[model samples]
Target: MKRYALQPLVIGALNPESPVSKHRQLRAILRTHAQETCKPGDRLPPERELAEYFDVARKTLRQAIDSLVEDQVLKRVVGVGTFVAHPKVDLQAKLTSYTEEMHRRGMVPAARVLRFDSVPAVGNLAREMGLAEGTPVVRFRRLLLADGTPMSLDDNFIPEHLVPGFLDDEAPMSLYQRLDERYGLILQWAEDEIEAAAATVENADLLKVEIGFPLLRVTRHAYVDDNLIDFSVSVYRSDRYKLFVPIQRHGMRPPRYTKITQT
Candidate 1:
């Protein structure tokens, strides 16, 4: 008996006369099936097994798998067979920085400066960064790497007035650490909204995921007191990150009926 259960493969049949290549269609099918059934840390069938099962040429199957890997749907191991990547999570309870989180797990954290440019703020983006409309704001976009492998894209917007001379300061490895040490800026709290999305062309290339692959988009505003300090949008490889929220019960139940307020 096979130890690993054979999941029901759901590859739809190719159009007999469509212009689209069968290899491309196979890639879509496999990607969809993996999204529906596989989570981070799941192992996929070997290339030979997948090719035999699909009755396609090895080249065809390899092409499909390669597409999936690029989209970040699947990841390949060096010597071992490819396994699903587990989504990373924050082990610390207090709101923490990505650099600190990765360091806690013994992973090397590095950032590649993709672009750093200053532009006039406008509309809600300006409001979120606490800049007057048309006021200059600095935008920093980086590809975050863990242990030399790409995992996420961080795009941060900051009001030019808040961090003076920020452009000259080669952003340290850890933004939070720098905020505390250099400028005496203390990061107190942040508000975050998380949603799922497909990797677009830009995100696909930056994250090394296939186009249209699933990802987690987190939009956040970090604040110091009543002033908004930074607005960041982070897109993470869904296969490489798992968001965890712990729930607790206080054993308090709502009253069966509300008591009238006394004057």
Candidate 2:
């Protein structure tokens, strides 16, 4: 019977005489509580205690909590009760490396290289990288993580000439940084096509999500002096990351990048 600090804010706030619906009011109150008072993983008061305090039925209380859960502000565990949810990282359309972006978000980023090898470029990949068919390409698959939690599964393809001697042991955490320092290849810009898809069994297994879970699929084509140099496809856990376009992409402060200092 530990008391939740948020319960004080909720007391006497469900004005039944107010024109607003009680459930809606309660939902707003809870949202405010979450933003102003609660941190991620903070346990909410039991449903029965909250319902009794609000003088509303359990159904109304549940309705309010349900909306917050759908919005990703709250999470429910069976037999465990509700808790504040960890914030989702927005996939901002900024031209920064994943390591740099994760640093900006105050999360540690790492890559677990699942597969790495040189292969012949096929029809679409050859055309995409502006290379002749059957050209040697270096392809690597990696499980990308933030704070040790799997966030994305990636397949990065590059013309072998672009990254000579690139091996699994020397795979870079910040590809952009490696390209700059090791190969002296300055990345110009990249274009991405994003879509939603269901996770495959392999993707589910690697990302630690249930099979058929929703994922954000991003295909990127990177350039150097207008020459396409790299093509990569990344599948991100939708529950952990959501994509967004900023009102202004340019003139923003550049990220403090994380270098390829780890194995």
Candidate 3:
């Protein structure tokens, strides 16, 4: 098999007299070169060549690369060379399924059902789903993928009565789509709360990241016609995903002005 190499556009040499450090200058130069010349998933040149070309020590070159990796501008495989990173997915605050969101971004979406079974609702599950204790509920654990890369681990719970035969093998990739098409239960609205978390050992393996990496935990409650229908806890890789919320000032009372009395 032919191996492809990453070729950054040639740029001016770094200025030693400048205030900026050499490593920082190298990082900036490489970032611009990568953005201009390399596509996502393009493999970078060997470390030795890159270091020699920049006339910097290997340690300094590695530092620059590490910074880019942390910023998600580049990705480093253990044995493989570094590569350009795909743009992070911006998740808007909206009622949409993972499949729909990925499709809108022109990326292929897939799901692997890690666990699907009927479990009795208890504790917070019962309270959140508004179901009696011991009521049957469909539990779905799925690994959501985009463009063949794992994006999130979703644990979803829904009232079993609302979705019959949900444990079958032929489950759809999009739970919302299945609900609407099979059970006529369309999601009307949802509320989500996002917080930063550390990836656990199990989640790290599933998400292909190192343990304790930063992650975004999103807790969601979906409703249909004012009835709580589904609840889910999804953990997303913070490096590959971001949440976008639009904020605007509304309903603020204008400054009260008193009419000035004529003298």
The C-alpha RMSD in Å for every predicted model, in order, reads 13.5, 6.1, 10.0
Instruction: Give the per-residue lDDT of model 2 (tens digit) for 16-98.
Output: 67999998999999998887788877999899988877778999999999999998889898999999987887546546788
In candidate 2, position 170 carries an lDDT of 73
| TM-score-sorted candidate list, best first | 2, 3, 1
Off by over 4 Å in 1: 1-94, 248-263
Poorest lDDT segment (10 consecutive residues) of candidate 1: 254-263
lDDT of the candidates, in the order given: 0.74, 0.81, 0.81
Candidate no. 1 TM-score: 0.63
- What TM-scores do the predictions have? 0.63, 0.77, 0.73
Q: Candidate 3: misplaced stretches above 4 Å?
A: 1-29, 39-83, 252-263
Model 2 misplaced regions, further than 4 Å: 1-25, 32-49, 76-83, 246-263
Q: What is the lDDT of candidate 2?
A: 0.81
Clashing pairs in 1: 41-84, 70-209, 70-210, 71-209, 71-210, 72-209, 87-240, 87-241, 87-242, 88-241
lDDT of 3 by residue, 213-250 (tens): 99989888989878888899989888787666544458
Candidate with more favorable, higher lDDT: 1 or 2: 2
